[model samples]
Target chain A: MTGAIKSQSGRLTEAEAIERAKQGDGEAFEVLYNLHKRRVYSLCLRMTANTAQAEDLTQEAFLQLFRKIGTFRGESAFSTWLHRMAVNVVLMHLRKKGLPVVPLEDTMETDEDTTKKEPGAQDASLAGAVDRLELQRAVEALPPGYRSIFVLHDVEGFEHNEIAEMVGCSIGNSKSQLHKARLKLRDALKKHRAEKAKR
Target chain B: MNCAEFQKALPEFAEPQRDTALQAHLRSCSDCSLLVSDLDSIVAAAPSLAASEDPNPQIWLQLEAALKNEGLIRQPAAPLLVPPPQEGRGWRLSWALPVAAAVALTIGLLVYRPSTHQNLQSTGKTAVTEPAAAVQTAAATNAGINEDQDLLEVVGTQSPTMRAEYAANLKDVNAYIRDAEDAAKANPDDEQAQESVMNAYEQRSMLYEMAMDRSLP
Candidate 1:
């Protein structure tokens, strides 16, 4: 059994586990799930902002990986492939719930107006002063379209082109949505600070 | 470049660049400079937010059951956590009898319904045991429904949040099963529809298994 073998060796390396899992080794599948579940769950949690949904999506994502592990050809890093699959699962769930996954191009033009810095407004420097918890709350407040782009780009560190391919948007659209997402976050954070001041 | 242009280009901007026009604007305008600083802070802080969180432990149990049901697990893996020698053995024995009995009953039903099995075989189709398979499916679905009821009873003992989550998930799976059943009835000859019905039953079974695992004392 793969579990017995792991007990003797301490643990199997990821490559060995992937090879074993491809052969339908249940222990190898568990090893792979343990290796990736945290990051996968975090991605889902950030994307959905709801623990129940995140938990369900995390299960679905791993279920998908298990079903398709036979077809993985190592064309990309395993983590990259898994992350892409996880993103797709979350997006599909969101679409089922009637949330827009991608902002339309016309809406993008209108969104830019909202993102523009006000004319001659005084600027508050958030550099070196932002609270992590506050930022998290602000992130969760973003609209679904902006949240998806923001989490994919800034939080998960996928580049624009890679994100474009995963979400089926142009590279330009990915960057634009990311910038708009940041602007929304900025406004959210500012509002949080203002509310704090009032209290 | 004006403030709008500077902010517009900011998303693509790399730091420490020698763009004199953008640099001059940043040097002159506090708002754009602070905007850049704020956006930079956000990017710098983003990775910290990516810290991984542990999911509920029952997820793996559910996943393992689904894998086994799908025939993706050829070998039964070792238990996830080894309990102390004194524990869980009685619980296992207690449940094992009923489950074994259920399996025996299912097998007995299949053996006694030889006419249905023979009729399917006479049809000369590749799925020669379709009727027998249907009988087994019906038995399994009944078992799944009973397990779901048992799960709901114990689910009330869980935290309200968990109970709500389980109820919502169970409702969704039941709805999926109904849809798949309708599809299978409408297109009885469609292999995909038959597979969908089976998949739906397996999903519900997995959920019940997961809830049962969580309910253990």
Candidate 2:
């Protein structure tokens, strides 16, 4: 009841596990990390596309989390609080390297002749109406802003207000981005389906 | 509301409150129905992307090491939507005890009383008690001794510029004292000359030491 129990129990009734971890209990913090790392890492991966950069961003995000965890209050759900932190970490990493801003135009129209050059070109012959792989490829191929908004809103289930605050934009901007994301996703799925038809 | 507004509100509709008008539209409009189905699929596929698994064990190790090092429970760069006020409270709280202790110590030192002592060697003075005379003599001698010790300490520790200034000032005072002694030998029983010479020497010594002390980093 001294270390681990104190932190876990203390978090529920007295303070949160995150709060306790900030006070210096490594184990208590580990529990909090385990709970959120998957979603955080996934967001980083989808944002970066490359495994190495995603891993680096994920690690940096968690490191920053620990460095600044003392600032967290239970005003928002812990996951929501962590999501804002995670997204900022990825965005900052992208900004630092001057990575191309994923344009907002939706690029929904892919040239038919260039279809075979897409990442999932080999999967064109695979048989399925809609699968996770197809959806993931579609999401990943989305412009960064729309992909991020789509993932945060539809995939991660954040509200537009939360997305707006995290992404540094207005709620109106978030909704517009989500609409663009959805339309792009819908187009990609349509193209995917059309490709299936030709095979 | 028309289908466009209804569709915009459809995402919001999932949260247990679906407007009656939107529900009515959903029942009638095939387009809205398809939109709902499309949203359902998007939502379904959304979690699968979330299916990106936990990081490798090494990353957990690194994260744990990082948290332990930083004493952090969550990410630090972006604060939560609502940051905790406890951190500010804690920051302010940290200074309270140290400040209180410093104030107490300063007060205690300021109010401290030194012990009394007597002098048997004082030549009889009118109203001054033997003990008071001894105390005054002791204080004067101690002051002179402390000044000399302070000068030596400063010489040992001060930077070269300060040391050179101090050494030069000390030589000038010594020379002035020598000149005053020569004058005193030449003209004995001149109280004014003796007093001025003594005062000049004491003031010079004090200035040299203070300058030395000031020059220390």
Candidate 3:
């Protein structure tokens, strides 16, 4: 009966929840939290690779979200806005800890490994050689730069331009880094599979 | 196309929609074909990877308590996820339950019984409104505290962090209780002070119940 909108399930839609949350509705904020905590927390954990720090960042991101929710003008999808905020939270924390953010400059020269051909990767029609668990482990073990681009591109499904905008890198840098990320993940997965075969 | 050219263009081949030339190269060139297949599988598999954990409720509790401490929201009747006091830091809290109960009971008896109510209605004063009334009410409040001690003990053993959280949340609630006590002392018959003191008691009870609700594994 109130002016607030509700979705089909009788719960407030994300937009309504956001509106209520902006008005200082705690339950509405919790509704938003419950809906996206998994994705946000997962993004934080993947980016930081430290559970405690990730948890801290997750909370910090949401608190910052609450503070900045007023500024959101519905220009982008809420998820994109939230994910970008989460990414920024992790980046800021990393900066505060004096961890160097790998400058995402466009590189003209290719890396030696990217230039090297993977013989097995060339002709084979892929079956199940790439294990999900193995690949996941490889990703978690990636350096922060590669891990983020990979997660943002392949995992979170952001386009190169979106990735560039979020991380303050060029679209070209995003594409380059994503290529390198995939290559490193391939190497990591191959090594993992080989180690398991040995065991 | 030679494998060199095919390999160089592999990044382009990774896009979801490959142009005819790239697809043609992937079809004819074994090495390029295999590379594309492997890369395709990799891209397909990436989105499934996720962190295996979520931020637990304690974080929410802390954030909310912080917001409340900063005077952001109107004070919630009882704080959420208040961690109990840290062990050996018991002196920081004012055990408002006993004192609050005493005040509530003294006020109740003064206004409730027919004879007392009639006398107070007629004269606007009662025998039980004297300072001695609080001393007598203290005995009943001590019994209530002893019972609450059991509840606190049960709530205490659950999580050190939760108890710590309870302590943090109660710190604010106690501040409210302290302010109400100041008002009550300044004006012994102040209705607002008496109501606030009782509200603090009710809020404390709700906080204890919140602990019980949370103690479930």
The whole-model lDDT of each prediction reads: 0.69, 0.55, 0.61
Off by over 4 Å in 2: A1-20, A99-130, A197-199, B1-36, B64-217
Model 2 reaches what TM-score against the true structure? 0.48
What is the Å distance of residue B204 in model 1 from its true position? 26
B117-197 in candidate 2: lDDT tens per residue? 112223444245445544643454355344444453444342332333334344444454445545443433444345434
Instruction: Rank all candidate structures by their DockQ, best first, as comma-separated numbers.
Output: 1, 3, 2
- Considering summed lDDT, which 10 consecutive residues are worst modelled in model 1 chain A? A1-10
lDDT ranking from best candidate downward = 1, 3, 2
Report the C-alpha lDDT of model 3 over A143-193, residue by residue, as the tens digit. Answer: 777888888788878788887887778787777677777877766666555
Please, what are the lDDT tens digits per residue for candidate 1 over residues B1-217?
8877887677665561357778899998887777777777887888766743456656777788899999988876643221232565535533543464345344434433444444555787526466656676677567656655545544544333334445545666667666666656564544555555555555555555555555444
Best model per DockQ: 1
* Per-model fnat list: 0.56, 0.36, 0.38
Model 1 segments more than 4 A misplaced: A1-9, A106-122, B14-18, B80-217
Off by more than 4 A, model 3? A1-12, A98-110, A115-126, A129-131, B13-17, B50-52, B75-217
DockQ of each: 0.23, 0.14, 0.16
Clash count, one per candidate: 0, 7, 13
